[model samples]
Target: MITISVTGMTCGCCVNKVRDKVGALPGVTGVDVDLADGKVTIAGITPERTALADAVAAAGFHLAD
Candidate 1:
């Protein structure tokens, strides 16, 4: 699993958005979003960091350090 700390997600829409976008990534089989914790856990064959970052960016969010 690849874990990314996320920001700017406030509600279910944000959660679903992140899930849909990141879930579309190649080899991504599962996604777990923790809204309170601001964390997104991605599973299945772990994708490239850049790819994930770009997807998050496109979704109107960002992966935090």
Candidate 2:
């Protein structure tokens, strides 16, 4: 699993959007978004970090370092 911090998520809708977007990416088998902690945990084959970031950005969120 890979855990990435994300910013700009404010509610359940945000969580679902993030989940749907990231979960749709290739090689992503699972996605868990923790709204309170601003974190997204991804499971399955790890894609490139850039791809993950792009997916998150496409969902209207940013990956935090």
Candidate 3:
């Protein structure tokens, strides 16, 4: 599992969008969005960091450090 700190996820819709986008990526088996903490956990075959970041960005959110 990989935990990413995401910003700009303020509601259920945002969470859902993030989940959907990230979950659609290849090798992504599971995704959990924590709106309260602005975090997302992805469990899968281990995607490249850049790919993960791009997916998050494409979903209209920021993957924080």
Candidate 4:
């Protein structure tokens, strides 16, 4: 599992959106969003950070270091 910080998510819908967006990426096995912590945890087989970042960006969020 890998954890990434994400910004611009303000509600449950935002969390779900982030979750869905990241969950659908290739090799992604699971996704968990922590709104209060502003973080997302992804579980998968060798998922790339750049792809995850792109997916989050496409969803209108920023993935931070």
TM-scores across all candidates? 0.95, 0.95, 0.93, 0.91
Model 4, range 21-45, lDDT digits (tens) per residue? 8999988899989999999998887
Which is superior by TM-score, 1 or 4? Answer: 1
> Which residue pairs come into collision in candidate 1?
none
Q: Tell me the whole-model lDDT of each prediction, alpha carbons only.
A: 0.92, 0.93, 0.90, 0.89
Better of 1 and 3 by TM-score: 1
In order of listing, the candidates' clash counts read 0, 0, 0, 0
Where is model 2 more than 4 Å wrong at Cα? none
Quote the lDDT for 63 in model 2: 92
Models sorted by TM-score, best on top: 2, 1, 3, 4
Model 4 quality (TM-score): 0.91
Q: How do all the candidates rank in terms of lDDT, highest first?
A: 2, 1, 3, 4
TM-score for candidate 3: 0.93
How does residue 43 of candidate 1 score in lDDT?
92
Candidate 4 achieves a global lDDT of 0.89
- Candidate 3 residues lying further than 4 Å off, grouped into runs, are none
Please report the TM-score between candidate 2 and the true structure. Answer: 0.95
Q: For model 4, what is the alpha-carbon lDDT of residue 36?
A: 96
**Shift of residue 57 alpha carbon in model 2, Å:** 0.7
Question: Model 3 over residues 15-48: C-alpha lDDT tens digits?
Answer: 9989998998899999999999998999987778
lDDT of 1: 0.92
